[model samples]
Target: MTDSTAPRVAIVTGASGGIGRAVAERLAADGVRVVAHYSGNADAAAEVVAAITAGEGEAIAVGGDVADEAAMAALFDAAEQRFGGVDVLVHTAGIMPLGPIAELDLETFDRIQRVNVRGTFVVDQLAARRMRSGGAIINFSTSVTRLQMPTYGAYAASKGAVEAMTLILARELRGRDITVNAVAPGPTATPLFFAGKPQEVVDRIASLNPMERLGTPEDIAEVAAFLAGPGRWVNGQVLYANGGAA
Candidate 1:
């Protein structure tokens, strides 16, 4: 339901690195005015905006915690002040830590839930209120929801909640012509994925997928681009863009 002829103003949260950065760059390249939202990395966020502006694409970096209302308010305000009303909201902010459920501390679990689950809710609620009638909202989930890998219980549970809320929110936006969807990626070769892993271990993990290599942030961003731009009929669907690995 996007106004395809008009410029789509998008707010990409957690855009400082990894999938988020890739999505912001791709959307800007596709002529979508982008607001690259980062939690604390102003430098990284500035770099993204600089790249876009250098290419004559419209972009700005807005710092805020996605789970905080005051911060999100400022984020939305900045988007309107910089461009206009938001037309696309892409929530790519998430975290995954490896620990068996038995060893997972309650504090760590709560923190992860707060960001992964509560942050999505916060962003979606704000986006639902701010986006144009024909806008689209994209949320992130992990293929672990389907794979059920060990040490992913808390993360998957949070995303499972995301899936539920996304569906219900679509119903709430019924006549608005807006669409809400989630993208669940498999093992991707972002910096987060490679961090602290031995090279041999990383290679072994990469080869497990049928693609014979780890997914690139660019690859996930392509799917995000489709959902954010031309993927109108993809309403309320959780698109698994994991190279058929799921």
Candidate 2:
């Protein structure tokens, strides 16, 4: 059994890049030993671990598909074998394919829901079963769920499900002492956000927020870190880290 005084262990999904990478590093800096989960990019995940190690932090890179139950079970087993127990789960692994609801093909919409909604449910279920008391489960949602953007139908729907699951899971945990919450980021400037978008479109989305600029990966990571650590009173809610984008 893990000692109460031992450092907390966190499993950060999608830690290979973007907001996930930043969250892994930030949590490690806060003295949480990290299991950096990657979907496919092993090298990028390794880089994140190396950076954390260089800063004298503890971390490991584990690769698995978020939507696969067996694969995710293996990931949890790996973390338990290495770090004793998991105290936090920052699930940032998801896909975003943009298109109008009517125009978007059924196949693509299904893929988005599979990765985003199903993925969140799978990991959150595993975390609920395994995480220790005082643990936090932070799932990723998007501000577009409220902004109601044109090309975000599929993505928004998936995230809307995420938000709903997060809230109810917190209540279900009841006496478990784990806090469940979703971070809804708006217009974050990551490679994922830059994909398939022109400069003009990017600028317009960026300007939708009062900050008048694209949010960095670090910006979103800060919110995840809070929910993981000191934000104990914040439970069963979606915290918008969008600089007033709503």
Candidate 3:
């Protein structure tokens, strides 16, 4: 049962699946009322809401394209109307369009940046504007920013922008008690990458990490939940939850 006076109200973008879905569920389980934002997957989002409520967590699914500024604004408006002001914002809405730079078309590159970078900025800006004093904002980055893998140039560039934004925002919100942080997870076993890849390629990618295993959505969610909840002293840090991988 949620207290009518609960202070933590979170908006989680790209919440239909993967890390977004996991974080939304985890935060709700932590007693934070969550707004699960998804672009088009209503069924999946409903499933997420069901899972959370079934687990005794409070959550609702909201649909909007994170890349659309108007839609994003509306998402926050709805969340605030339903659950009060936003207290935490988790930006997990991003695309990992991987391909060699030489082969990457402009359309693909722009699309990735649009969703990953621009969308992150939009939501983070909104969070800063409306977050209660001492709230948290968690952005999603990738270990590729450190590994600098060959085929991930464009994708890494987007996450790099996220890292820079998070750092600046942390400093900007220094006196407000709003800790800004990012999570850089290595090869996660999500349909985001594994579903379409060849078996051998997937194995090779997972084995690249020191852990010799793929990261799970739940693994990253655990770290994100910590940062969103109790890790106030851990400000301006990109918790690289890649299991010893770069």
**Prediction RMSDs, each to the true structure:** 1.5, 0.9, 2.3
Better of 1 and 2 by lDDT: 2
Residue 16, model 3, lDDT: 96
lDDT of 1 at 37: 95
**lDDT of each residue in 3-98, candidate 2, tens digit only:** 778999999999997999999999999999999999889999999999999999999999998999999999999999998889999999999888
Give candidate 2 regions above 4 Å deviation: none
Residue range 1-246, candidate 1, lDDT tens digits? 445577889999999988999999999999999999999899999999999989899999999888898899899999998787899999998888778899999898998899988999999999888899778999999888998988889889999999998888988898888899999998898888888889998887677678888889999999999988788888988988777777
Models sorted by TM-score, best on top: 2, 1, 3
Best by TM-score: 2
- Each model's lDDT: 0.89, 0.94, 0.89
**For model 2, which pairs clash?**
none
| Candidates sorted by lDDT, best first | 2, 1, 3
Write the number of the candidate with greater TM-score, choosing between 1 and 2. Answer: 2
Model 1, TM vs. native: 0.96
The TM-score values for the models, in the order shown, are 0.96, 0.98, 0.95
Query: How many Å off is the CA of 91 in candidate 2?
Result: 0.4
